[model samples]
Target: MRSISEIGEHHLIRRIRERAGDPPSWVTIGIGDDAAVVEPARGELDVITTDCQIEDVHFSRAWMSMREIGAKALAVNISDLAAMAAAPRAATLSLALPPALLVDDFDAMIDGFLDLSRLAKVPLVGGNISRSPGPIVIDVTLIGSARRRRILTRSGGAAGHLLFVTGSLGAAAARIERFEDTNTQGSYERSEGSYERPVFLLNLAREVAANRLASACMDLSDGLADGVSQMATASGTGAVVLSSKVPVDPTATLEHALRGGEDYELLFAVPPRRRRGFEKIAGRSTTVTCVGEMTKAPDLLLDEGPLGGGFAHF
Candidate 1:
């Protein structure tokens, strides 16, 4: 068996296809496209989330520019808001920078953060910056507002619900491996291009919120399997994913989809009756796959099999 770095991106995604499954009711879209959309609330629901990016753990200076780092940090957090089908209004950023980094580079990083903020139409209201003895770190907290009935959450899923994901999986993993290979050949541009630019699925979120299509929702920052498991745990339900139907990146392989993190896509669930509406909307867009279904059991299964392998954080 080859490691994810050796299998390349597309091949890794192919592996994920073998274990993917469908989502529950209200999930309008799932993996194999640019974004995921879900409806979990009826009227209005507020959304809140926080995420952190560490220099050596989440990223490295050797492979990422300060600008890219800043943008990615902000994008990941906003992606969380999008998962809940909420409109992000403001964010607070906290930065811990090492003294070794030049002041100009720091300024560029701030510019990058601001760039993403403007693009998302979310203001950077306040934050704290300080020196760090180790590598750079960034923590961002985002606040979003949704109608009380429109807010989506990870805990609403139940038995007989369908499963869904937004966007193709494994692109980021493929990009990482590609970067390593290209860097060895002194071709940095191609490697950089493989790195995913943060995508704001605000439009999809708005649609889901307005429609009340998702019973539960969460972002795939870790991995598809892990994200679904989190949702299952939150909702006190079990799930079964079909290994063959998972939507993966055309260029990525199974390994990438199973273990790669940082995809920053959305994963959601909905009841069975609402699956048609989801399919109808998804048909006009990119492929939104039915990867699995929810169960009353508390276990999370992949490809209708036991769950053991996937990404994990220590």
Candidate 2:
């Protein structure tokens, strides 16, 4: 058996892909991308998703506050829904907390979830809590609804469709790198804030669904390259992402933009003719850029180069 480190990231991904099998019909999109999309029924589309955050695995209690953890747990799942071009309506949370956690601490965490829920206009419908002998674990599941024929699926992208991404990438990844560097100071802490408070692009999802402007859509949760590759694979197409056209934080490196996770931004495919309309709808606050174009082949190329990878979980 090959060790994960020895196999490297791409090889591990290939191995996983071989075992995962084809996506289901309702799953217009599946495991390869930033988020999966499932069509619940005809005329009405419901997006279903879940994400888990474990202490030390996904975050560190030493660096992250209870509030941040709570908010992130919810935001990330909703971000998945947004990727499907759906509007989140309800959520359920399951928490495993250490015995040492005080009741007040738990309350603060709930408060954080509630705060973001209110902002997103999604409510917490139900949940479960329990004591854990191990590290803290948070699992969140969200359900979002979309109008008939409006939900975007990764499989919809085709050759000639233009690829676009919303907001800057790599800020969160850069922040995490800074936090790991002992030589860093207060600035590093500030950078980490981006990771803690990710903006969920619900409004963008609504616009895409309403206008049917996007040929395909998914959020940038795992990193731009990985997300785009997923779309290509599902749609039975290929893509060429120009590195220069990708929007990255001024302070972040190109590598970070390509592989960073937790950015919670949207990556979509649109018809060339609709490019201007999407740009106008995205507006000034959110940076939208045409990073690539879909191709007939199944390969995912970056700047006409080999595949640019993104974050992965084994």
What's the TM-score of every candidate structure? 0.78, 0.81
Give the per-residue lDDT digits (tens) of candidate 2, residues 1-314.
Answer: 33234444444334434433453455565444555555554567667899998987787665667777777888888788888877776667777777666544565566767677767766565456566789989999988788868888888998999999887888778867766665433311323434323333777767866887888888887899898899998889988999888888886888889998687888889898888888888654577888889998777898768876798776
Clashes within 3 Å, all models in order: 59, 0
Look at candidate 1 and tell me the lDDT of residue 280. Answer: 65
The candidate maximizing TM-score is 2
- The per-prediction CA RMSD against the true structure, in angstroms, equals 13.7, 12.1
Q: For model 1, state the Cα shift of residue 194 in Å.
A: 9.6
Best-matching candidate per lDDT: 2
Q: Which stretches of candidate 1 lie over 4 Å from their true place?
A: 1-46, 177-199, 282-284
